[model samples]
Target: MMPFSTSFASRYSSAAMLVFALLSAVAPLAFSAQPADNPQSPVLPKSAADWRHAAIIDIDEAYQLSLENHPGVYDTANPDFLKNLQAAKAAGLALAVRVEDAAGYVAATQAFNVRIHDGHAGMSHNLDAQQLPAERWPGFITVWRGDALYVYAAETGGPSVGAEVLACDAKPIKQIISTNVFGFQGRSDEAGHWWVRAPRVFLDRGNPFLVLPKRCQFSLNGKRSQDSLVWKALSQQASKWRTESYNGEQLEVGMSEPRKKLFWLAMPTFAPDEKQREAYRLMLKGLSEHRQKFLEADAVVLDLRQNQGGSSEWSQSFAQALWGKSRVDRRVAAYGAKTEVWWRASPGNTDFVTGLVEVLTQQKQIEGAQWAKIQSEGMQAALARGDKFFVEVEPALPGAADAKLDVKLDVKADVFGDPPAFKVPVYVIVPGQCASACLDAIDVFSLFSNTSLIGAPSSADSTYMDVRTQLLTSGLAEVIIPNKVYVNRPRKNGQVYLPAIYIKDLEWSNANLLKTVEADLIRRKQ
Candidate 1:
């Protein structure tokens, strides 16, 4: 039988699911709708005309004006070098029109990206984007019972959908969000995504999670009713539920006790690891054997609010296990003009001949050789004709085949083939800190059936391209390179392809997207 507990969170009611697809009665736009370019953002050059007519903004100059130009990068040599290269590119940033402050920088960057169609690129706001009314975040937290911090809540369809704050700054995220969201007003609650995420458009800035302090006090609407003793025990034992592993790619696995029937999984990276691979296998196996139990659960929450992303393999695995099918066909293709045509190389290997004279195009390319090499630029270097042979591979499906993409994946996402079958509702939780692979994960996963995004908007819009560069400074220890990300498609094609559910702000800040299924299962058993 099901026993009520105040500590357990995110239960599903068949009745609730029926109405879950709706948006909140109050227009979130009031707080969320801010003009492009926040005042706090840096002013950036817009058009080629502006740059030519105005002061020359070198990569270093632009660095001072970009969102990517932060001190944290300097904390370590690797990040510092990356930021320096990023800074150099920032100098040459093409703007629609330069605005006054940081908000303007972000606003113009986003607007321009949308125009050219670059979404995966990053954007920083200026005064203009920051001009929206300040929003308020809930101080308390609502955690759906799980191993990670995933606390499930309804996809925002109404005011009642959010978690109720029970304490003053009582959750780990509350403090962090407050600290990291640099431009946000104390009251600003814009959940952080751009208005339009198109090709070449850049958006998403700041690391919001690191700021969240460790301790937090909270309460659950449903968790308060059951046996006080056991419920209290669960609450006191809350620390045991907290777990994180930088070593593993997958995260969180738990069955909600209060919500009894729901199951939960929170993934935080695109990089899939061995443990994560095994956990996923086990999860699927468990579901197969307990199909009745699986079918019985009211909801299943997949929490990824803190997920930064790991691998394309994991994304596919996730689609298959949950929905039992995918629509994408698995084929890889690439189209690029190679001056050195005849020869094509694979991921590993080396040496190439560009009409014989092409020993190496750039010093960069030569230094970063994949494998083996020709003796020299000797014209005699006719296609090494040696036992040495390398296959050329480009993006027929860059975003489609994300394995090669670092900052930006090619268009289709890990290459061609689509996923099959996915009626199980999905709720993606994005935060202000969401970027790169994390944003890609959100965008790609949204294509599945019954999918909705909650929390904050993505820091990136899936637009534009960024050139990865490594700085040449003394501490420059790693390679800094930028990936130019261009948007490949339009937004809102159809309901099946859209986010059926969305949450603007976390009133209770509990992000357990799938556990709602488990919670329902438990309740039903009662």
Candidate 2:
């Protein structure tokens, strides 16, 4: 969610910059300087001497630090947010003996983070921190799907795709998802997001009940199978995964066959780029030219499986082009009534004020043209009165029945445009990888009368987003905390976003899933 920045080095005085550096040491982190609310804040390593300064954090200190410093505990509007933190604190305390090393500390905090159940809040072990057992968890990638654990993709000679796991160390697959996927990962309702991930974490961390042995047992296509996985070096493992390869290319839109009457549009990201934006416009032009063909087509596949996220502007642009100008009212109506969202400025966080202006303008709560004038006036007034300026945002209710305008009378002008929407069935392919703007796209696309979502449940749309990062006192890890809670229905109810149609056969592989969609579309036509 880091916004595209033009070096505004001239904007801040050296004194103000110094204030921010000092404030970072103590100020409460909330929303970062990004509009979509998920910016990755910079995390710097401690002094070289400090790296060797080994200190043991007791259970009491750990719990107290989490309660005070965790963004999930302090920034969320959810009433039960505190209760969840307290429960995790108590649970971690009971297991405090494990906190002897940095790896153990990460496991403890990660468990606490998962309990918060907001995907926006997380901790990344400092690159210098001791590696965890799970960091070395063998090669297989397991995905959790509706109580069943299936091998989606695996390293060569590892578990075969489609293999079902009956148990790990004799615990049922259901228990693994409940305790490890949902419980330990803090994924809340998004089990599919952590299916393949939880197995590795639980096995390496020595989770008391759900641990996986070196030699695992499972069933492949209803036939019993076993595999022995050996520990592989990090460099070797990294190479095996091919992190440099482009997965999106595998799902890219192919040439449209004029006679077939079906179109596949693969959106790799919603992040704003001039070329991508132009490409989007051309796509709209092409679709509009084929109006009758699109209307009569069986389905148009909006591939968003590999999209991590980007600016919401791209999503909004696509929406306007697809539906034409008339449907803007209905689209705005889906947001429901606005709810109060609040934030306080810290002495050093001038960037937040900038971000606030952008968000308010986008939400139509404030006039965009006068944002600079208003911000300047507001700051001067607050300074004169010797008062800390507090900002509040009113966001429309997300996907509710009584949806009404939040602090304004109308939707943003950009939502309505010249290009009309394709009056055909839209199938949005969202695998577990979707988040941020991708989730925002889901919200917009879902409003269409003919749109339907297919694939696994998406990564939990942690409505509480935009991280403010803080370095742990131990210097072993950086806690990424989300400051703003998106005022949406799902956040209030503690739920994850679900697809309209859950595809059972499609595993984690994007290539396999896209092919399945093509086959399903072809089958429907037949």
Candidate 3:
């Protein structure tokens, strides 16, 4: 199963499935429907003007959805988000008027999604279904190391692997990346954003809006040289390598003895699928069996370098196994007291929650099923009462008379008893791409007294979450819209979590990572 952003909990809800089913059923009708004048009928663009007009309609629809449903638009304290939204819409419309082809129109719509500064809010289409032109890339890929960009991989006759890229087309390499890559993709002001998107600088992913560089200046063997660019079709093998490099090695989910007294728990992803779910269950069971060994270990490295996100509850379960459920619950309750979640009461969102309840129940995720049920009921009531949002307050502490556990997994009380107070120092390895439920994992680990973050700052998300998609009228793309907004959350939107111990110029390979972390631990004890 594919990993998703933090907004994945309700992704496969009945409402979403129903929408997809309807879209599929009506796709034929939409294609062969009446004249372009009919708003309900999909416009098959046969000319440049037709494509531009269709794109404008789609952009307007997306903008309206955001205004009506996105919680960020309603945040009075952050008026800039609204202002940016308006600007992006205007820019997209203006660009649409000038575009003469499908590629141009796609880039125009992408501008709106990019300016939102949100990873969850974007326009995406299935390339195979759309039969779009394939993406092209220069015969090399670059990665960020220290403060400079270096070639990580190269085809024969391309830049050397260790070469530092200085400039492209006489423009500074950083400037080129900021404009061509991040500008068309979503742009964020956070350092983690740059770190995550840096690798895409040299790849032209079918966006006609970008101007590919003609020549690049590279410094190798202490000598500077320039080479003319040669764009080639991106091969499947090359594409796979690029993705793996950016996301890090996909390690198995289990604990290991990396050293005599040091342990390593490699949890590369928390993707919520039957196989991954079973893997997490078995890992937790193993942790339970070896609880004493971990508690007495010198250090434990919770490796999350490649984790993008999935279900956050997986990480919470891990924390509960080692830190004790009562302790973790109390910490969560204290944090929850100061926070609230406001789910939009729109018909689509309410419907999504209703469907989510059924899906979670079938999956045997009792805690999530119960939470979805509460939200579904609350939203329906809010809609009936003419309220715009349904509010959910944090539950009281565990021992309180009205205390309710938000999430209770299948850990038998008698089998594991109350785990002793964990005293081992946990070093969490977070890469720049760590986000969504991955960020949730960081939050869980931080609650413990003996935890310290290492590596780089993690990518951040806004208070907006739990996304649902609406297909554009053109049927070529879909717009992702978030349903819930956090009120008084501990971390502000776009705020990254900085690691306590930063590893400078650290290589991301598995062996090097373990060696580096071990060396750091030893030096600290000196």
Q: For model 1, what is the error of residue 68's alpha carbon versus the real structure, in angstroms, after optimal superposition?
A: 18
Give the higher-lDDT candidate: 1 or 2.
2
Evaluate all candidate structures by whole-model CA lDDT and list the values in order.
0.31, 0.51, 0.70
The candidate maximizing lDDT is: 3
Give the clash count for each candidate.
149, 12, 0
Q: What does candidate 2's lDDT look like per residue over 1-526, in tens digits?
A: 2221101110112222222222222323432222234333323324322222322243344455445544345454566777876776566554444444444454565676666555554454553423434344466655556556666557778777778767656656666556654555645455446533444432344444234455567787568977766755444544344331212234443225423766777677665357766777777777656666666776777877567775445555556556664464444443533433322233322344455444445556433313323433454454456544333322222222243334253343334353444667677877665666677677677766778787767765654444456555544455554433344432243344577666666243555555666776677668
* Candidate 2 Cα deviation (angstroms), residue 406: 12
Q: What's the lDDT for residue 488 in model 1?
A: 20
Pairs with backbone N, CA or C atoms under 3 Å apart (clashes), candidate 3:
none
Q: Ten consecutive residues with minimal summed lDDT in candidate 1? A: 1-10
CA lDDT of 58 in candidate 2? Answer: 31
Off by over 4 Å in 1: 1-260, 272-274, 287-296, 326-422, 461-469, 476-480, 483-526
lDDT of 3 by residue, 357-380 (tens): 766677675655665677789999
TM-score for each of the candidates: 0.38, 0.68, 0.84
Better-scoring candidate (TM-score), 1 or 2:
2
lDDT of 2 at 111: 70
